[model samples]
Target: MNLLSKFATVGGATLVSRIFGFVREMLMASALGIGPVADAFNLAFRFPNLFRRFFAEGAMNSAFVPLFSKALEEKGEAAARDFATQVFSFLTVVLFALTVPAIIFMPFLVRTVIAPGLNVCIDEAALQQALSCEDRFGITVAFSRIMFPYLASMSLVAMVGGILNAYRRFFAAAAAPALLNVVLIGVLVWALWDGQDTRALGFAMSWGVLVAGVAQFVMVTVAMRMAGFSVALRRPRWTPDLKRLLVLAGPAALIGGITQINLFVGQAIASFKPGAVSILTYADRPYQLPLGMVGVAIGVVLLPELSRALKGGRLDEAQHTQNRSLEFALFLTLPAAVALFIIPEPIIRIIYERGAFTPSTTAAVAAVLGIYALGLPAFVMIRVFTPGYFAREDTRRPMMVTMASAGANTVLSVALFYVMAEQGIALATSLAGWLNALLLFHGLYSRNLWIVDRSLVKRCCLLLLCAALMGGVLLLLMPLLSHWIQPGAGIGVQVLAIGILVAAAVASYFALCFVTGAADRQMISRMLAARRKRGARNA
Candidate 1:
């Protein structure tokens, strides 16, 4: 498949998954708003998700995709499959070992790292009246243990997903995450409809996570089998390939862990403030939609493509891929950042300020969302640039850069939390994101790995201009349409108003892109045409 086609496949599937995720978050907000239950659930969810980055999405994919793609290209399918099996066996053994200890030490983790604020609040009578903080802490620990096994299952899914993506079978791998959201939504709906209390709902959601993990793993494993690459568990062997993978994977895992630690710091700090954890999570959801669709889609496609190109000694192709990936990433992400910054209040109010979620909560979450918006482009660019290092099998430098970013995040988050509260934590994350992106870009440039050309620069500048214009339009229109997006407005009206505003923003941005000649309409048309012809041939 062509680059755009592969990106569309992954991006389109991811868009679906993110939409379901939005629904899942919306339901959770309505059912459990920013209360003790919501805080507990988010804290528990964060545990596995933090490790998911380290084990599944970030570290594992970074190390596995390039090497597996190389094996497939160089030796043959049998050799690649054998290597995959060996890795799979080793990964399963390690994850199984890790999960047991993590589950056993869940309380210690919650006390020291995940939610220290809970212990402090357990003595506050007022907080106890709302929901017993001691009980909530216990629930958080139990929920975390229940959800910890998901890390193992999802890590295996990531391995199979890497195999599929390396072979250009992107659809099933990309779509697997949607199943988790779907499962969560069902569990939440049932819990809400049954009039279950908050604690029961939280417990149900934790179990839902385990069920969904199993389902996702099954779905991707089926896809791998369909692609004629069934990687089954075998006796653990210390092969040279496996050892090299571990070497690369160790640093990548640390890099991913560092990024998650930044989040951990934010959450741990936010935990001290009532409802701040859920507020930050709610704010984080909207920006994640664009980030997942653009940044993740581009990164997933770019890594293996770059590896194959560079391995084949195709420098120009690799360069073009890098440039286009960055251009495409910014093309989608810049406007998203602008919209989030410009209309955060209306967006948060319309989507989340209902049921138990209040106007005060909306305002707080909006502030956090706006701060996070400032870093959206930086976050996307980091994803686009990091593949340059990973595809070249260089993980140590990125890990070092992440270390610096984590240090900055820690200092800033601690310093800012006392001053600006939760918004400060969000702002600190944004600043750290920019620092991380700049450092990654500098590393690539210093190594002569990334070459920025004129066309890429011009397009990026035009994209910024278009986004600025879109932001202006949004700022101007928001006041006029404020009543329809207010917390008291009817939900249907709010949805319609937000939809119209978003549609206008998207239309105007694309129109400006066309007018400025920054976007190549003919080139896009040709790509679509080529995709169609290829589809016909396959048929």
Candidate 2:
């Protein structure tokens, strides 16, 4: 398949997952609102999710894919399978070690790292403490313990998914995440049906997370077996291969998990205020749809593609891949960033303003989502550029850059959250994301690893203008549709309004792309022609 086709396979699946996630979040907002239960549940889930990113998506994908790709390209599938098995065994042992300790130390983690602000309300009113902080704290700890096993399951999923991705089997792993949202939505539906309280719902969802993790792990493992690559259990050995994987994975942990690290930092700081964590979490979901579809698809596809190209000494192909990936990222993301920045309120209101989620809460979440939109491209660029470094087996530099970005985010979040509240934290995360993206881009350029091609520069400029023009159109359109999108509108009307707004925005942006010659029609025709030729040959 072509590059864009491969991207679509992953991205399309991610789009499905994000749509389900939106439903899940809406249910949570309706059921729990931004109250203690919401705060506790969000914090509890974020803890394991933080580690899942650190281990599974971040370290495992970054460190494992290239090595697996190399082994497949050079040493053949048997050797690659053997290598995967070794890593699997090691990862199993490590996750067991990590989960057992984390569950045992759940309370301490909740009080200190998960939500330190719970212990001492910085606000003079002590509103946070008055809101049964001790009870919320205990709930967070218990919920965290119930869900901690998810980390192990997802980490293993990553290992298996990495193997599938290396074999260019992207669908299974990409679709696996949808199960988490599916499972959670089922739990929410059941809870809502049974009229369960927020506390009961929280516990149910925590267990749902564990169940979803196991489901995801099983799905990917089954896919691997079907792909003729079964990774059997083996004695964990400290061979050179295992040692090498460790060396590469260590620094990569930071590089891969930069977004999660920033979010963790923001969550920690946002914890000082009651409902702030939930507010930020709610705000975070809207922008994540675009990020997951564009940024994640590029990251997953680019790493293996670039690794194989580099391993086979295909420099031009590798360079072209990076350029196209960046171009593709901006093409989708720029418009999304602009639309979200322009119309977050309607989106948030339609999605979350049903039950305990009030108009005021919608406003709060919208503001944060707007600021996050500003950094959306930077966040995706980090995903696009990091592969350039990892494909070449240079993780330390990106790791250093990641650490610096995290430090900036921490310092900025701490300083800003005090002043601007949740919006300040959002701004800090965006600023830090830009810093991370720029450094990665510069590193690639300065080292002669990647050069900014003229086509990319031209298309990016055009896409930016296109996005701005689309934003202007949205600015003009929203007021006319305000009646339907306003807080008191019927849910069906609100949904229809958003659908109309998105359709118009997307229509205008792509129309502008073709009009401005930003989108290469000839290249698209060639891809189509290539696919037709392949189909004919198979026939």
Candidate 3:
């Protein structure tokens, strides 16, 4: 499939999943807004999710796909299947072993990494302004213990999903996360029906994560079978394949872990402020939508394509593919960044400002979301650029870049906390994202790994022009529509106004793109054609 078509296929399904996810979040927010209950829930949920991002999103994918793709190219399907078997045997044993220690020592780890967040970090004066919520370490501990082993299930899913994706079976892997939202929504609804406190509901969510993992694994396993891959477990093997996977995964882990560890820094710092972790979680909702749909979809799909191209000594094709992917991302993601930065209040008000999510909560979350939007493009660009290295089987270099970015993230997060209040934690993350992108892009350019080809530069200029026009319209219309778009107003109004703003931005962007000829109708038409072909295949 062409770039835009691939993105749309994944992005459209992803968008559906995200919309459902937003529903789940809305229910969770209303049922357990940023109180002690919400704090505990977010903490418990994040335990697995943090690791999920580390393994599924980066470490495993970075290491596995290139090698798997190479094996397929060099030795055909049978050889690739053997390689996958060796890798899976080793992975299952290691992760299963990890579960035992994880279950046993999880409490201490929770106390160490998360205990610091169980209470307010603010001083006496700030306490008066902070959200009213109890300090319930008892509830936190109970929920955390019930939840932490979900990691074992998640680890299994990540390994299996990686294999499926490597086999050019992305639908199952991409659709896996939707199961988590499904499980959580079901559990939360059941809890409400049973009239349970959110603390119990939080435990339900954790177990739900386990269930979701199993369900996800089953789905991918079935998909693999349809594609003629197998699930027969074999004796744990120590082989060359295992060694190679580990070597690649280790560096990818360090590179990816930088991002995760940065979150720990934010959680550590934000923990001092009551409800800050929850606020960060709230802000991330909108940020994650675009990030998931385009940024992650491209990263997930791009590496293998790039790896195949580069391994075959098709540098020109690899470069061409990279430019097209960058163009595809720029066309969609820049406008999303602007929309998030400009319209966070409407989104926050619509989706979250119910029950315990008060006016003050809305304002706080909107500020953080707005700040996060500042780095949205950077976040997408990282996905767009980093694949160039991963496709070439270069993992160690991204680690160096991530380390520098993480260091910057930590320092800025600390400095900004006092200067801009707790929400500055999100701002710091946003800045780190941009800084990381700049460093990666520059590093890639310096090594001549990524040439700023003419088309990419032209597309970049077009994106800037489009962004300027979109921003102008938002600035003009936002004030005129403020009364109708009040953040504390009804959900319908907030939804309506935000919808209008988004439509305006999209329409303005398209009109400008057409006028500037950043890309022509034929290019878009190709994507539409590809989308139809994909749809027919799925049908």
Candidate 4:
């Protein structure tokens, strides 16, 4: 697949999921509006996603795919099949056993993880001025309980996804997450029809995640079966393979995946404010858009490619892929980070401003969005860089880096939470992100692993310039777009506004790239030309 085609396959599906996720969050905002219910659901949703990223997404992929690919290369499909089946069977048993307790103790988890905050909003005038909203802290315990099992299923889905990646089964694996978004949209729409009570929305959304997690797991498994990858039960072997997986993945689960940890850090600190968790949650979505598309995409696609290349004794190609992917990340994500920082108000107002969520809340959430935006590029890079060490099956170095970064993040978050409020929490995360990146690069340099090539560095400078030129277009266009898509604006108008802005920004960037001879333009053009040819041939 061409680069844009590959991006489209993964990012296109992700964009669908994110759009539906937007609808889900909109229904949630209309119904819950950043209060106790929103807080409860956000925290509840966060717990599972946190571990999902750690154990399943980054950590698992980092460890498993390289090894699995090696087995696939050396021993053929049967050996890889046996290994995948053993991992899956053992994974299912362990996840279920762990999830059972988590579901049972969901209340305790909420209490422990979300540190006791100002349990009640003492400022009634503040509430009345913002909107006629009441504090609803009780939902946090019950709704969180309803949603914890999602972790178990999603963890498995991650493993299944990892197996699929090893097999180069990218499409189904990429599309799997859209199901979760679809389910949440259904449940949230149902809840919207019902009413705007905190419990009504919280319960619907939480239950949606649980249901969606199960559905996704089933979908991927079916896809696997259809591909003739029959998964059979095997005892947990803790074999050399499993041993290597654990050894490599454990620390990455913490330090390298510290971005996930940042969510909990923000939540723990936000618990003090009645609606703080929800605000953090709402703000996070925008940041996640770029992070997932650019960072997560490169990480997932490149790991397998890198694994195969390195395994086949193609070290130069492996390093080239790594540099090229990082170049891709910077090119795509920089402007997202810039737009988020520059115009948080319009972005928040456009996506979420509605009936119950007011201007003040938008401003508050926007502030956090700006803070989080500062870390956006760094966050995307984490996914890009960490795979370098992981694909080599050298997980321990990353672990050491991860633990050190986690310690720094934790200490910074705890200290900064008291000093700066929600923004402080985000700032701490931003600091920790740069710290983690520094350490990763330091290790790579110390060992003389991979360095940015001259051509790539030249391309990097041009990418920044192109992004700057695009930002100028955005700064000029955003206000016009926002005004055209005001709160009372219909969905058609809103869609048009977003379409124009996005198209304009993308076009401007490509024009700048062509002018500057940036790296991605030729790759992107080749991708578009290939797509056109594919379309023609299919017709």
Tell me the number of clashing residue pairs for each predicted model: 0, 0, 1, 2
Candidate 4 per-residue lDDT over residues 184-208, each given as its tens digit: 8888777667664555666777778
Range of the 10 consecutive residues with the lowest summed lDDT in candidate 2: 121-130
In candidate 4 the C-alpha lDDT for residue 409 amounts to 77
Instruction: Put down candidate 3 lDDT per residue, 1-539, tens digits, no spaces.
Output: 66566666667767777877998888888888876667666776676667777787677778888888888889998888888888777777877787677767766766677646555434534442233434455566667667666666676677677777776677777887788888888998898889887666777777787788778877777777888777556897778877877877876766655555666678777766667878888888878899889987888778877888899999998888888888888888888888878778777888888776788988899999998888888888888888888777788788889888999998999999988876778888988998899988887889998877887898789888888888889988888778878854566776787778878877888898888977656789887887777789999
Task: Name the candidate that leads on TM-score.
Answer: 1
Which pairs of residues have clashing backbones in candidate 2?
A: none
lDDT values, one for every candidate? 0.88, 0.90, 0.77, 0.76
Put down candidate 2 lDDT per residue, 227-308, tens digits, no spaces.
9889888889998988888988988877888898999889989888888999999999989999999988999999999998
Best lDDT among the predictions, by candidate number:
2
Over 4 Å off, model 2 = 121-131, 526-539
How large an RMSD does model 1 have?
1.6
Pairwise lDDT winner, candidates 3 and 4: 3
Q: After superposing candidate 3, which stretches have Cα over 4 Å from the reference?
A: 119-135, 257-259, 487-489, 533-539
Between which residue pairs do clashes occur in model 4?
117-272, 255-402
C-alpha-based local distance difference test score of model 2: 0.90
**What's the residue-level lDDT of 470 in candidate 4?**
87
Angstrom error of the Cα, residue 229, model 2: value is: 0.7
Give the C-alpha miss distance for residue 434 in model 2, angstroms: 0.2
